[model samples]
Target: MPQRILIIEDNKDLAHLLELHLRDLSYDVTLSFEGPKGLAEAESVDYDLIILDLMLPGMDGLEVCRRLRKRPAYTPILMLTSKSSEVDRVQEKPTNGAP
Candidate 1:
């Protein structure tokens, strides 16, 4: 069976494009434009992976992740963020000795 996936993204174009590409790769993909709806979809189905956008309507990806982590069953989550942040957030030491 194809691996099931759920994508929670507010960007319609990006989400649709991703769905198309994943489908071509033989993966089953489902999309939700908001955090709450995505959470509902996730609970209703057993997805192999979840592609979640950091910024969302109704709720943010951080909150969604927190809630999902509370569940007994484990489902891997892949979070995506378009916003740029400090390199330290990724826990990497700068090669140039910069913070």
Candidate 2:
């Protein structure tokens, strides 16, 4: 079976593009336009990977990632950022050296 990917991007256009691209690669894709809904979906289902964008409505990606980690969710997260600050923030590993 194809691996499933969840994309949580507030930008409608980017989310659509990602869905199309991943679909072409034969991966099952799910899209969410807001952070709350995205988090709910992520927690409720199993996905091989997640492409999450920072600066989302309702909640930021960092908080989302932290929450996921707290719940022991080990899904690989690829955080998308338009700001250099956001990129730098995500690149910083936790003090415990977790992914």
Candidate 3:
């Protein structure tokens, strides 16, 4: 089975770009524009990886990441954000097998 990837990006163009790139790489991709829906999907499905945008509506990506971590959901997460602080925050997390 293809590796499953979840993408939470509000920007339509960027989301489309990511989907296209991952599809070319032969990975199954799912997208959610809002934070609540994204969080719901995250809980419902088993994803190999997740690409989350920081400036999501309803819930911030940092909070989402923190929540997932609290649940001990160790699926690899790649945060896609415009904020410079996002990089700093990610560095604090233990990234194991993350691309």
Model 1: how far residue 40 lies from native, Å: 0.7
How far out, in Å, is residue 89 in model 3? Answer: 6.3
Candidate 1 lDDT for residue 13: 98
Give candidate 1's root-mean-square deviation (CA, Å). 6.3
lDDT values for all models: 0.87, 0.87, 0.86
1-99: candidate 2 lDDT, tens digit per residue? 999999999999999998999999999999998888899999999899999997799998877777787776588899898887756766667632557
Candidate 3 per-residue lDDT, tens place, 17-84, comes to 99999999999999999888898899889899999998899998877787787675678788887767
Cα lDDT tens digits, model 1, 13-75, are 999999999999999999999999999998889999999998899999878877887787678
CA lDDT for candidate 1: 0.87
Clashing pairs in 3: none
* Every candidate's CA RMSD: 6.3, 2.4, 3.7
Poorest lDDT segment (10 consecutive residues) of candidate 2? 89-98
Superior candidate under TM-score, 2 versus 3: 2
In candidate 2, residue 31 scores what lDDT? 94
Better of 2 and 3 by lDDT: 2
Off by over 4 Å in 3: 85-99
The superposed Cα distance between candidate 2 and the true structure at residue 44, in angstroms, equals 0.4
